[model samples]
Target: NAGVTQTPKFRILKIGQSMTLQCTQDMNHNYMYWYRQDPGMGLKLIYYSVGAGITDKGEVPNGYNVSRSTTEDFPLRLELAAPSQTSVYFCASGRNQPQHFGDGTRLSIL
Candidate 1:
């Protein structure tokens, strides 16, 4: 059922280019999350939503924006991108303990 899907598995952007990382889930999870993982570290939460029309900034929300318009889609927006933002992004959704994750979107800034 395509539990979690992300677009543009790989992307390259200029120093100030902006892009949106798309994520959608077919599981109808009320909880959706956005995280970024650097080369050698664990994932750090960027943003999260408990349900539609509700969202909260997580540990590393700087330079990023998120909105939960529907239960299935939660997109992460990067404005005025920078080199420091180059990392692997993951989108997850779940109802409880076990969460489902998308393969990930690898972003590079030059």
Candidate 2:
């Protein structure tokens, strides 16, 4: 399996611009998740889906939206991005255990 991969690695956005940080997994795992980690804190769940066509909000879902249409892709959308949205985004997977993570997509807003 290719595990999870995130694009750009790093990005800088103005106060109001937006973008979709891409995430894809080659593993056939049924569970996928998106999380954001602020400095010196644990990961906060943003969104997750158990399977295709099923999705749900998570602890830090505000300012972000996600769609899980296929088994391999779960892209996160940021609209009217704000400085508070700046954080390291991580994509993960696992069924009954801890998740395997991407290096992370580091985003900064100025």
- The candidate maximizing lDDT is 1
Cα deviation at 95, candidate 1, in Å, is 0.6
Candidate 2, poorest ten consecutive residues by summed lDDT: 93-102
Per-residue CA lDDT of model 1 for 1-45, tens digit only, reads 789999989999999999999999999899999999999899999
Q: Please list the residue runs of candidate 1 whose C-alpha ends up more than 4 Å from where it truly belongs after superposition.
A: none
Residue runs of model 2 more than 4 Å from their true location after superposition: 96-98
Candidate 2, residue 82: CA error in Å?
0.4
Give per-residue CA lDDT, model 2, range 25-90, as digits (tens).
887778889999999999999998898888889899999999989988889999989999999999
The alpha-carbon RMSD values of the candidates against the true structure, listed in the order shown, are 0.9, 1.1
lDDT of each: 0.95, 0.88
Model 1 TM-score, 2 decimals: 0.97
